[model samples]
Target chain A: MKTKRIRAGAAAMTGVLLLGACGEGGPGGSGGDFTDGKLVLAVMNDQSGVYKDASGPNSVKAVKMAVADYKKKHGDKAVVDDIEVTSTDHQNKPDIANTKAQELYERGGADVILDVPTSSAALAVANQAKTHKKLFLDVSAATMELTGAQCNKYTFQWAYNTYMLANGTGTTVTGNGDKNWHIIYPDYQFGQDMTKSFTEAISKAGGTVQGTIPTPFPNDNFATFLTKAGSTNPDVIGTMQAGGDLINVVKQFNESGLKERGIDLAVGLMLITDIHSLGVDQFAGTMFTDAWYWNMDDESRAWADRFRDETGTRPTFEHAGNYSAALQYLEAVQEAGTDDADKVVAKLEGKKVNDVFLRNGEIRAKDHSVVHDAYLARVKKPSDVKEDWDYEEIVTTIPAAKAFPPAEASACSM
Target chain B: MNAVLQYAVQGLAAGSFYALAALGLAIIFGVLGVVNFAHGAFYMLGAVTAAVLLDTLDLTLWWSLLVVPVLMFAFGVVVERLLVQWLLRLDPLYNFLLTFGLTLVLVELVKQKYGVSGLPYKPPKLLSGRVDLAGVVLPRYQLFVFLFSVAICVLVWLVMTRTRVGMIVRASTEKPDLARALGINVGRWVTPVFGFGVALAGLAGVLAAPFRAITADMGNNFAIILFAVVVIGGLGSIVGAVVAGFMVGLVEAFGQAYAPTYAQILIFVLMALIILVRPAGLFGRKEATA
Candidate 1:
């Protein structure tokens, strides 16, 4: 009888401990009311499509890395030990992104969605985030609309945008005395925004906008457009094409003898993957702007080393941006002591961030634009590259204040 | 005047790709009574094969132009025997469905092996720079592609007209029922004819390797435009395919040059206008079913 009473007492103690573990949402123990006692990070982007090489699967891996680093840094103080990362392919379609974003928020129980690449798809997802009242950190998509006309309380425009790209490349190139410019861009939202931003920057820097050409997105041939751009004899031809289209334009430009005709080429935006696809020699001595380079500094190279070890290729700016965004999101969750969207939004807004991807970064409260220092780099000559994937040589740094448009100029009423 | 001449040359040069791929599509459709929707996939495979050959085997563009077609021909024969032959007697839609499925499989397989960023192929140093044709300078590579594709089309035309085997194949393609009634045995030539047609597509791909982006989806737009070419030329009409291929290329080039916003739309407009005029296509023989 005495032993049976002792056993019942032990069972009561064990039950109480289990109850405490389940109900712990205060201070230290699994802090905050987490859904299912865990955090779910959803990464949506183009996985098997044209933009795959730029971000795709690598972005997912970067998030996992961020989770690991966060756990390591926070150790036992980590808000939630069971952080889960899930991913789906949006295929760069806005409708698909809308459907998938709804499913992820409603059914999949994702707390936050990250790394949406295409601007149209990203906008669709931003709408879903607002409707669902879920946190979203956009890493790859570059349209300024996210922070301009389309800004919301739940969405944060994380990486570089069309405004930042144009502000850096346009001002730098025009300031270098290539006063007359002709721009060719894809006839889409992102391209239209880029053209507008570039024209503004060019005229501001005393450069004349000679012509503007709008071509189809994902077009393989640029010979016709290049010919038209060259006929007017602009001092520099600014190409606002990206991914496979950009490669075609560059290749055709060389083949068409445009460089020989004394017309300089200025890329509106470029990534390391592009340089890697078409060797450094194709873009030798060409000046362009980049948000982040893997080999930028020792801190970045250290992170990049870990990234390359996980993924076969070096991380692009999108990949690094994802890592930074994820880590920062988790940090905000921890700071707010909960994964609640409103609380996390308060935590992230106006927060200064310095990381491998974002140099002197600051998340603006009014517009939610993550302003950061952008690099103006020249594609190193083939002979200058000492190791693999060493493509860019940083020439100048566009400071964070000058990299993006002022918050007061934003069209976003939010 | 120089700009106009340049645009003309550019249009013709762009047309060469459509002309070559459409010619194969026309021949295959002519002989097999199959739409062969995978013609675009075959073109993609051709360019990919050339790029891979150069990347892996250290082969040059010259060798690729010579070798890729032969390889594609062999691949075409195997596909015809293993998958396509089984559906030959069924409704033509079945064959179309089968080839469409084949295109998906081949595209995914390629994407699995080589990621979507695309591969690089530099033209031979001999053909890399520009060629001055009087005052209208053209890229030597573009000029070479135009000339090379024309030579190939002529050779194909000769084979279709001059030889006894060519005559038999032509008879089977143009009037299969009549040829079969005459005891020509149209079944025997189907395999080689299909192989020959795929080879032409592969040839076009090889020529395009140095000129266009060598990606898995490179053939997607090319294929769509090729359908417009075949339709504009009249389905299964060899001369029509070639003529319309160059015609569409010129239209697209000029459209892109002058009406930048309506470049793609212009191709369809031209297709619509031609269809309105010639319901049977410029070179196609109107069939009872059609």
Candidate 2:
């Protein structure tokens, strides 16, 4: 009888767990009514895998900081109350990320979802946001598809896209006498998109593509690819790997002493988070572009100082984007005077948002793309830096018009 | 010729890690007949322990290489005595399930504690740069890992073959009933042997810390691959495990180099082909018919 009781207890516990896992929002979960009349935000990103090093917990912290700042500025009538934030580990898988977003929105009472780091995963969540009629402010996930062919009315792409990074870096480097390009890219959609954009941009700037090599995603051994790249003997070798794969590739490339062989390393999209993982010594002399840098301007520096004080690390591009998106989203809701998704989205569609990171950045109604300055940065030398977290030196700032892809090219019906 | 030599060196460097991990898996299976799903977790623990020690005590890689495995060995002993000992009398499948569950628990605990953001571990200053090896430059750290792994494997072989303790271990696996009849406390040795196998895994983790990103789920992929290595090597054969580990590493490295897209698929294909030819593994002994 005692054994039977124990078996029954185990079965009951399993039932409870399964129900909890499968249930829609219980009280106080995401997408529930904000009883306290405060906007709750859900910051979802790959808390693990390739994007984690740069975009995970720090991004959540950035959004929180933005909420705190917004609350301070609009103290009386614009009080942001009961603001809660939660995160999920997407592990770079689209299916897992999509499920997590659904859970966040359906059960967590999130008014706005921010900082999804993968492109495919971002697209999944964007689709879900439209179905749910919720606001999705994409802080990362650079595929133009989120604001282009796969664009949804409820979604906004706030940070750098593949087109911006590709055009900014590729055109500049190839035009400046580094005309012959060799490419080593990950064999995925993101990699293919980057390579395609880069090649077109380079050729458009009167450069030639010597060769291209696509490696498997999450590939560890890069010696073979590096050796093959060395043989091609291009003016510059454009790397399209991200996260730990990027670190491994750069480290191995350095180890092979290939830099001495006259092949320059050019990164397609190197974030502040990647630089932090790699350190200054590993990335010195490497050039890349980003939407925001912690030390770029007084506003960014001041905001980063506040963020670092709270989070104990420098804010990454995804983190900065989260702050930008959250601030804009809350402002739109305030302007719309209601939390109705369509009303708030309409308010945000053609509005110009000024935040600590972006100056006079406008939300394009054409595809919900945020138009802002894109920074062309080079990794600062060890001797050039005076303190920790001081890495990039901003080379040039591309204007909003030149930085964004043309609406015709974007192919975003929304 | 230079490119081939370069790829070969790269393959050997990577193979060293696979070989060390496979050796641990083989040892556990040979003596205890447990698949040891937590071996990779133990490996991750080894790296994490080293990182924590570096933070707390400012320990260098030299000291971590010494201290981390010892601590993990004690942890292994505790786990075996408390958890694994209960499942010994049951079917091997029960042990597999128990250990697999333990792996999930350990990984989750680590993720909770470390927060899933990969912690970076820099190589010691001495091992930071590359060395010119026959005109091909190789990282000094990779070279060290290769040599260190081989030395440990040799040391393990020596202890297993040249000592009386080794004889007893072999006898226990071969005929546990007879070994117990001969007045050997076979039950007592099980825990320590398991602990030792776990320590070997921990050592592999310590060696891998600088080379790879130290994350909570680092062990999951590696552990699965380690099983494939053991299977290809002929499960429960130490020498076979080491050989097959290097073989898989080489195949994977070269396959990724030449084919690019089909690199991971090639590994599974190789394992399938090997199993077709040798169902019991390359070094596995045929079972005696009743």
Best model number under TM-score:
1
* Cα-based lDDT for every prediction: 0.88, 0.80
Which ten-residue region of model 2 chain B has the weakest summed lDDT?
A: B281-290
Model 2's CAPRI class is: acceptable
| Candidate 2 segments whose C-alpha is farther than 4 A from its true place | A1-40, A47-53, A79-92, A99-111, A175-178, B52-58, B125-137, B288-290
In Å, residue B147's CA in model 1 sits off its true spot by 0.4
Query: By lDDT, who's the top model here?
Result: 1
Give a tens-digit lDDT track for model 1, residues B1-290: 88888888899988876788799999999889889899999999999999999989999999998899999999999999998999999999999999999999998899889988888776789998898887777899998988888888888888888989989998887788999999999899999889988998898888888777788888887788899999999988888999998999899889889999788879899999988989878887879136
lDDT of 2 by residue, A134-239 (tens): 8888878888888888899889999878988998899888877889898999988889889998998999999988888888777666777787777767888899
Q: Report lDDT (Cα) of residue A269, candidate 1.
A: 82
DockQ for candidate 2, please give it: 0.30
Model 1 Cα lDDT, one tens digit per residue, A140-258: 99988898888888899999999888988898889999899999999998899899999999999999889999997668778999999999999899999988788889989989998
lDDT by residue (tens digit), candidate 2, B1-290: 88777777777877877899889889988888898999989998988887778767889889998998889889989998898888888888888999999999998888777755456666678887678977876778888988999899888889888999988898898899999999898877788889998998999888877666676777877887889899888888888888888888787778766776776667778889988998877887665111
Output DockQ, candidate 1: 0.68
